[model samples]
Target: MALGMLKKKRDSKMSTDQENENEQNGNQQNGNQQNGNGEDKEKQGGGPPKPVGFLDPRMKHVRRSVAGKWLLTTVVLMIFILGVLSIYWACLFHVDQNLSSLVVYVVDFDGQVAPYNTSGVTPLVGPMITDMARSMVASNEPTLGWGPLPPSAFDYDPIKVRQAVYDFDAWAAIIINPNATALLYSAVQNGNTSYDPLGALQLVYIDSRDDTIWYDFMAPFMSSFMTNAQSSIGSAWTRQILQAASTNTTLLSNIAAVPQALSPAIGFSEYNLRPFYPYQVIPAVTVGLIYLIILSFFSFAFYLPVWMQYLKPEGHPPLKFHQLVVVRWCGTILAYLFLSLAYSLISLAFQINFSGGNPVSSSTEVTSTVDGNLNPDAYGKGTFPVYWMLNFVGMIALGLACENVAMVVGQPWTGLWLIFWVITNVSTSFYDITIEPRFYYWGYAWPLHSVVEGSRHILFGLHSRIGLDFGILIAWAAVNTALFPFAFMFMMYKNKHHLHEYWA
Candidate 1:
């Protein structure tokens, strides 16, 4: 009976042990299932793994915002408005008022003197020319104004004068040799024997390329001097003729015998006086438009890279860079064309007297009735439109050039420096119109000047002189265009590493 009871107890203990082991195994299985479920949930919730070097979330948000676009547009528009204001200020008040005093130094080398003694003649002639210049200054009554240098001063030496010419002092120097005057006297005497006094004088007019109050002071002075010089020559000839007739019986007889010689010959006939300011409204307007269009193109081109950053992702996409550049240039060209046309339309609608008459007419008379001579053709009808088109093309090319340069520098802000430099170099105000002398060189070299001058010739039907200006403009365009592809290639090469690193 005791053996049986012990066996039962052992059996019971075995059964309990088995039950506990089963329960623990079931618990383990449940825990494993729970862990597996948790892992599945994590895998489902977490999403695909992000690749390395992802852009920051906040940065992406900022990039997507419209604020940047608005800011860029606003800045561009402000710059454009400023440029327009500058042109308007230069045209209306500064150019017109200062038109009369365009030329300041009139050196008359041709004045009457007693004999071969240059010493005696030098003092008299020098004072006489100086007096003529002073008289002209007195007649104009120019008010002093601000410039890079002081107003109303003349620089005499060619080198000094050239420097001043660049600096904007003394627009023109009239070097009149005594031989020229003698030729005029001889021509006048010959005309008394013939019908025409044909003598050409070398008027060395050093044009100060600046448009300012000093030009106003110089123009009238120049006009007066020219008139007085011609009159003086005519009067001198008359005096000589009368003296010969009075003193020489043979000369009087000859004069009386020849009706053609004795007949009164008309003196210098003034026709189509050159405008005081070389630049007029239409050309100025065209230039302003060109500036605006180019700037707009640049702004658009500049934004292209920013936009591209969003489109291009991962490994350098096939043809993506090429497409971006082409798109940029194409967009720039389109924008330039639109802006140029708009500007032209606005200018025509306003009927702003560009001095050559209606810019819209093709068969428009070249000469003004009152003036009765060929008005200085500011624009050569069809030529102006062609110039504007060419300008648009050039600006687009420039845009590409700027883009390539910006990419090469690896900084967009460098373009602002370029723009600043261009503006500084092109603007006449930086050089003193009255003090510095070499402003003409600066003027002639400036792209804007060519545009202005060339446009004038085109609009005014004066096609003859537009060649040089157009050539210069074309040369600038060509140079910039040639540099663009190389610059772009360099940028591509330089930034090649960044391409795969960031996007990939």
Candidate 2:
């Protein structure tokens, strides 16, 4: 019994020692965990755990693995800088070479036709200008598509010629009036002091259609051409009058009476069919459209958190993938509906006219206009609704693409995509594509181009290509809508598998 008792006591003492060693080992293990790099670090004031720095020894493999990715990122950025920016930089290269796109109709309505040729006198002015334009057609020099047509093309009516310009049938028209040579001969023969020089020739053009093209390209060319023609005609007429004076002393007495008519015997009447007026409309149609694009792009960022709320389910079950897509589509459209209204109101608030121009009772009156078809607007009372709808569609077109790209690319890469988006759109939209090189033809299908064109139609009472504009915008929205589901699916897959965690 004594030996058994001694054995039990020894077993109890050894068990106690083993328990104390286990307690000490547990304390050592807890202390080591608290001091670790990647291991959980307890917060002092009950906050969430903080992550270790990238330089931590525990992240050694992660650092090494991301090295090649960093190099790839820098290389891609360099390429993007050049590739995207070059699109805009090259937009206007050799713009002068495409001058033939601006077709200026040259018509001779003077003595060449019926009723005006009663004197059987050769019309010197009409043939002179028309022949001059035809000669330039074959030359390698930069020339307006100088399509010198007979008076029959415009029904032998100068009024019809003006109407053709107003209807955008031609960029400009140089019309020789029926009395061009008649007035010159009568003035010199009858000694008439009432000879109007501006009645000899007419230049009809619209400045509002494109200020850059008009002021920069078209005006300068027309100026130089008209000046040279006037100088030549004046010199020729002076020599003819002197020769006539030598034959008839009667003509010498008449020359002394109306010698002013022989100097600048003819002049061009520049009738701008539509002028760029009220300067305030410049922003409504031009740079303000850039803000419209920016507003649309940022809308995605603003509404993302709200949309993402649907991705998480706090009180209800998770939404189906397709249902979420519908949510995104409906939600985005709803947002755009309101946002576009706000944008349209900004133009309205500034009192940019939405009233249609007074209809010309006689199209010939356009040539007599002092300020070029005053008080012009596209759609009087109904303009606001149409304008709002245009902006709504444009926003959807631009914003949807931004969202889809951002979903696929994510943060830093999305920034690059925004730059790419702005450059491509601005290069194509802001400038006249007719003057741009053939390479920019694809810009016709771009979203901002449609928006800019549509805005001009609305604001300036220009041509009505709104149908085509809305069609393009809707097509863009439809395509981006189709891409929405796939982009979101990719995003979700990245989230589920932690694929974005690599670089994000």
Candidate 3:
């Protein structure tokens, strides 16, 4: 009985101790939960984590990483490209609508006067004269207006026409000499081979001196006039040929071979006077932009070393020769890609008309038409693959050359900036002068001009007159590629002292 009581007391004591231990553990766990909540609340109140600085351990994975820079560059480039595309769309729409509003002037110099019965001319003469004048004016659609001027209108004065042309009062003027019709008939009758039938009647004169404004006005009007003239000449010759042939079969066949009215064996099939302003102006602007891009890339490339130097005050440990070479080539490639993309986007945005089709969408179409003749679709059906390929290669070569030169200059930032300013000024001045006597001299010496002109030829089949442009571009590339290895060697040789100092 005593042993049983002892056992029950021991068991009761053990159960009480176990319950106390459980309560203590629960209290500790609750305290830990409270601490965790406090920490989380503190973190939320402190706000988002601050960015790691350059020297921070967290930034070890962030600074100068290829992936990070590439991503940043790509995002920026895509935005630029989208902007450019929008610009091109807008430009195309604007041109389509505004093209028709361009003004044109017509000048008639034919001096055939309206006949008068009191002046002893036949009664039919007045009507004939009026009819011819009306017909000449009527040829164009939306017939402007026509009326006779007093004899005083001629006055045989040169000043009137000159003043009118200068004042923009008339787009063109026709000063018809009084004896023009008589002269035409007399020449035809006398078998004078030198007789001009239209006898200055359609003597189309334009103010070629006002290049910018005049060309814009003249292009469409001249295009229309040429079309009309060709039709009229063809019809008249056909009729005269048939009339002559009616008398004799042999004579008709001979006349067909050598038509009396149509002395020329060949006739003009087509002529397109549509001013290619977009084509010309866009390329020029692109050339200027290309120079700016190249110079900027070089400036950046050159600045890289200075930045790295600043980061490592003691002097950077020399990279292995091969590694250095690899870095240089890679940087150059990257710069080229960046600049090319930038240029393309800008051009598209500005709606600068390029002759080639879109490279991305592969949309190539035969858009050019000369007179009424349809030229064979020579352009590629898709984005001009060959052109883009050539352009890429050429552009890379040019970029490499610029990079090498910058390295040689030792202070690329300054050198490139100076070169850019000089080239820009010279190019602007060269274009300003109407007569470019020294075009050959200057164009050959300037690489940018040569590259631009050459690229135009390769892509759009334009401005191939500069003889050595292609050769020069190829030569520049070859020279630069060869120099790249030497440049690496030179940098290694030059930096040997620094390397020795660091290693020592």
Candidate 4:
């Protein structure tokens, strides 16, 4: 009994001490409340994530892991962009130097022992013009391959030279009329006011073939050449007139009769065989076409989920692998068909005269000048359908490659592939491959090149490589089709073998 009582007294004292201790703790906490709060050091969130120093030992493995990923990403991006994307820049290299690929025919019909030159006067104009043109080829400057075709080459027919320009055999033709010297002599002697100097030379080119090349490179150079040649010929002709005037008093009267010829002796009659009339169509062929690839590539992302529903293990039984591949091809193609139509409609909406204008009765009828010169469509009224079908084939050619690459390379890297794809296509397709480096000759076989060429044929009536273009694009689609199953099968293997996980 004594021991139990002692134990009770001690227990009661201990409880009182415990309560006092609790009260003291509460008072201390209330005092701490005055100073923000009685918080442990960790409750402050350890002051956001610190900029870890290079040598800091804490989380060494974690930092190393992050560093490795960053390094990998940096290296991969640099190598991919610099190494792969550099191909585009390389394609454009030495374009100015390689401009000889753009052939410009220089035909001299002036008094060259031709039926064209019945003029008794010696062939001064044609020789002078031909010499001037040929001299350019001998110079150090970069210029078009001035192939001087003899008048006989075109059967001494100036109209045939224009036909050659229309045929796309030559980018341009500088023709000196056979009777140029004869007419000039007559004008000087008779003071014929109707002697238009523009009749002497014909500068024939087609602007619609590749307007950018024409405007940027060819036009400027040709203009400069023509200007220089005019000045040269003008001075030479003045000397010839003075010499003839010195020969006879009658000839001196002729010089006074046609004093106006002393100033503006000659001029070039420029004929743009097929003009790129509407400026609005520029986007359809150029930068806008890049979006075609963008649309086709990202269509996978846009409609992937819907397509994936069929592949899912949930609700319905999954589609067979082969069926899924077929579905992807068919769906992608159908989507492109509609997408391409939508794209083509934008051009039509702006009234890009898809209606076949009056067809040229002869090749000589085509010209840029507005003498009722309609910008005729190559395919007539069927242009829109052909255009839309081209876009469809283009999409298939381009998008299927994207799909195949995406399957092979997978995400994050696929975006890089997109850059590569866009750059190569733009470099080769939008720009003239003829003027580009030989490295880009392979681009002729590329899908976008074919698409662009076909578009130009359909829209601008440049050249009818449509059959060849379509063949190239179809070949691409067929080749991609051949490889489609393998690429998709690889993707399936990755899924089945759990190669890529947690992606959804």
Q: TM-score of every model?
A: 0.43, 0.82, 0.38, 0.85
Off by over 4 Å in 2: 1-71, 247-250, 357-375, 497-504
Instruction: Tell me which residue pairs clash in candidate 2.
Output: none
What local distance difference test score does each model get?
0.47, 0.82, 0.44, 0.81
Q: What TM value does model 2 have?
A: 0.82
CA lDDT, candidate 2, residue 123? 87
Per-prediction count of colliding residue pairs?
Answer: 46, 0, 8, 0
Candidate 1 whole-model C-alpha lDDT, 0 to 1: 0.47
Best by lDDT: 2
All candidates: CA RMSD (Å): 15.2, 6.9, 16.8, 6.4
For residues 1-504, could you state the per-residue lDDT of candidate 1 as single tens digits? Answer: 999999999999999999999999998887687454444444666765333333654346556676788898789868965874454344334443544434434443344323422433222223344565565446655522212111123232223323343333444544433343343333333433433432223233322132343344444544665667556544554566668768767666655544432223222222221232333343443345446435744574556665456346557544455555556556655766776666555544554333454322322121343433333344435434665564555455445455556767765555554655355434532333323333334555555555555554444443334677667657766776666656655766775634343322
Q: Predict model 3's lDDT versus the native.
A: 0.44
Between candidates 1 and 2, which one is better according to lDDT? 2
Q: Rank the candidates by lDDT, best first.
A: 2, 4, 1, 3
lDDT of 2 by residue, 77-171 (tens): 88988888988898988677889889999999889666667777778888888888887787879888888988887777888988888777888
lDDT of 1 at 148: 19
Model 4 lDDT per residue over 1-504, tens place: 999999999999999999999999998886566334323333465544445577766557778999999999999888988987788778768877988888899998777645545656876778887887789899968888889988789887789988888788988999997777777888888877677788888899988889888898788889998998888888999898888878778877766767656657788988877778777788888888999999889987787678778767797766766677788888878988899889889988987767776555355656442565455676778888888899989999998899889888788888988998999888898788888878788899989988888888888777577889999999999998899878877876776733233223
